[model samples]
Target: MNVTESEIIKIHNFIDLLNSKKDSIVVVEGKRDASALKKLGYYGKLCEFHSFKGLINFADSIASYKNLIVLFDGDRKGKYLTSKIISRLEHRIRIDLSFKRKLVTITKGKIRHIEDLSTYTRLDRFTVL
Candidate 1:
């Protein structure tokens, strides 16, 4: 699959934005999701939503953060989890879902989980010098 230059640029910008975040906590589905973000150069705080017993604990764990980036899978479970998190944490935590939506669209239906993001964004492997 050929991704346009614009797509690469957007992914780069997205990674940069995540890396620059200081007051935000990224909530991913699991360790793989966190690893994918690490591969993309995000060194900020990352919490695995599935690790917590429930939304209450997850929200409490990240209560200190001013913003939360929920990078869940694009699948049904992901959507349900995202909704639950938003419903419980919306008042205190600022949530961002744009990245996940754009990522799901950009993958061309090849990927549904956040962990797969690295596979699409790894343009370096296809580049030739």
Candidate 2:
């Protein structure tokens, strides 16, 4: 398939966002998600939370930094977790969910979360909303 110029630009923008916060810890869902990001060449620090309490604790510990990107999967669990996390640290951190565009896919007439964006079409021209 042909990778559009806009897709390349979007990928670069995503990479720039990741690299801009290389010093801060990136809070993600689990190892798989982190691994997928690493495969995409993200070299920033990654922190994985297995539970809500753990997530809270992690957020509390990093409250001093004031820079964090919550890169969770695009699913119900991820949305729930994101809401919980945002509620706790809404004022303390700068959270961005731009990566969700990279986790969405169309499956059997419905949009769903696959392992990664590579399973579907490249998110070249779409916005995160």
Number of the top TM-score candidate: 1
- Write the residue-wise lDDT of candidate 1 on 25-117 in tens digits: 888999998898888778888899879988888888998899998888888999899999888888988998876776666556667777876
The residue-level lDDT of candidate 1 at 17 comes to 77
What is the Å distance of residue 67 in model 2 from its true position?
1.5
**Global CA lDDT computed for model 1:** 0.80
Stretches off by above 4 angstroms in model 2 are 1-9, 51-53, 99-129
Model 2 Cα lDDT, one tens digit per residue, 48-82: 76633576578767776656777666678978988
The estimated TM-scores of all candidates read 0.84, 0.65
- Whole-model lDDT per candidate: 0.80, 0.61
What is model 1's C-alpha RMSD?
A: 2.3
Report the number of the highest-lDDT candidate.
1
User: Over the full model, what C-alpha lDDT does candidate 2 score relative to the true structure?
Assistant: 0.61
